[model samples]
Target: MGKSLYSQIGSLQNDLNATVGSTENTQPSSKVNRVTRDAEVTKQQILDAAVIEFAKNGLFGARTDAIAKSAGVAPRMIYYYFQSKEGLYQAVLEQPASEFQQMLEQMNLEELPAIEALQVFLRTVIAYEISHRYQGMLLFQEANQNQGKYFQQTNWSQPLTYVTKILEKGMQEGTFCKQDPYMTTLTIAGICVFYANAYENLKHLTPDVELLSDEMIERYTQAAINLVLNGVLA
Candidate 1:
């Protein structure tokens, strides 16, 4: 029999820590760096596979075996990394928010005018939804089937707060109509994700459309931004 999954993961973690500890003490060797990189790659591979599985099947329908097979790892590896399927599902749900936070952090949103800021936010979110098409589908599935139990556990406050501040700034600056920031945020997010959520049906309905193509995505993004900004602009 091969090595147990628990032992395999523990060993990899130990090796990773040892490599990092050595690097802290002295200049890192090429071999140590390579090992560290490989470990990180392996972990990411597992996450990539889990994302696809969970997105396609949702939590209740997803299987650890399928994820492991897709990742080219042993079945127990999933448990070793995530503890359980539910844990992996939670990670999938949290990924978009984490990525969204990182993307927003890189932008100089505070300095932009409120109207421009809102437009930027809308474009960014719509682009993200298009690029990560599975994420929107997964979110829709969770909302309808699981009633957003896993989604609630994720920390979305950062992006939500960011959008709320933009709306408030717009209202204060007299660039946008006064509205409930939270509700407005919901509406904006709905607009950004609606196409992605309905992609399958839309594709079936319009076989020639290629809705996810770059040109179409650009058209959709621009149209959404225009529609939203027009509705709220003072």
Candidate 2:
């Protein structure tokens, strides 16, 4: 066994850290840092494997043994870290949800006029989902098959709330045709989300096209934005 996985990951982290500001900004490598990085590396390994398993088999159907094998860790490690299968699934759900929220926070979508905000939101969400297509499949399973039992437990409404606010703003300004913001928000989300969630089906449109390639993503993003803007236009 040459360099272990942790060794490889640690080396990569070192390289990444080196690219940071001037050498004066660097901290001396410490034992604690290495230990912490390795632990996080292990956890990320488990999450990455769990995404694949959960996407293929919904929460009730996914197996710990399979996840452990795919993660190259002992089955016990999953229990030790996550406490239970549900807990692990929650972590998977949480990571991406939190990331999207953070991305939203950074975007300041509320500052823009409703129409511009809507376009930005549509493009942002479509791109986000396309980049994480596997997670989109996992989300589809949870939403449809699991009845969103796990998702509802999360702060999943933040994005929808953002959309609703934008919609209400547009309606108020007479830029968008008046409609129920909450209902319209759901409709708009379905429009953007379906492209990624139904990717497996969409891929069969023609064998020649790479549905997730950069060109297709832009096309899909623009199409979704256009559809929503057209429907809402005053």
Candidate 3:
């Protein structure tokens, strides 16, 4: 059974108590011997665990003790690498930005026809969004908690920039409606991510809805794809 929201926070705080009773002594490891692979592995593990905690609890509610337990590391090690829990949250925010940048690198968006490129981009975004749905909530938490200071700092514009380019190409090719590409990109993104970021509220609204089930995901993905294509395609 899942823990209640407040319970999750309480449990994590308890774990934090166990992991690092005193943070004053805990600091980033000063000892380094050429950035060993083992250390890198540890950082990755911590990152993975931190993502879960940050996503579930947000920055203020997330507890490093729980993250330490999940990552199978001493609390100090988190401090060693991330310097602090907030630092770890910032890194978590960066993970998706890094991923999107890497995904862009792997795609030959420029070679594809504008419509085809847009399709491919939507598919990729949906897949990425579904897999990391929690990050959207994490981002929402960022906005509500800090007025989006960290979000503004992150490189989240890579995909959007590509979408803008795709719109320009489609317009130039006379295949898509000539409209403001930037606003269109935002509209497309919102339409695609609506269900994902609204899970908490939505699940309650329709308690029977299997939001993450394979059937629902496929339905939502197709619906989003079709809607965007219809809107943009001339």
lDDT of 2: 0.80
lDDT of all predictions, in order shown? 0.77, 0.80, 0.77
Q: How high is the lDDT of residue 157 in model 1?
A: 76
Q: For residue 191, give model 2's deviation from the true position in Å.
A: 1.0
Ranking by lDDT: 2, 3, 1
Query: What residue runs in model 2 are displaced by over 4 Å at the alpha carbon?
Result: 1-29, 143-145
- Better candidate number, 1 or 3, judged by TM-score: 1
User: TM-score of predicted model 2?
Assistant: 0.82
Span of ten consecutive residues with least summed lDDT in model 1: 1-10
lDDT of 2 at 61: 93
As a whole number from 0 to 100, the lDDT of residue 189 in candidate 1 is 80
Identify the leading candidate in terms of lDDT: 2
Q: What is the TM-score of each candidate against the true structure?
A: 0.83, 0.82, 0.79
Predicted candidate 2 versus true structure: per-residue lDDT over 58-99, tens digit per residue: 898999999999999999999989999999998998777776
Residue 220 shift from truth in candidate 3, angstroms: 1.6
How far does residue 232 in candidate 2 sit from its true spot (Å)? 1.3
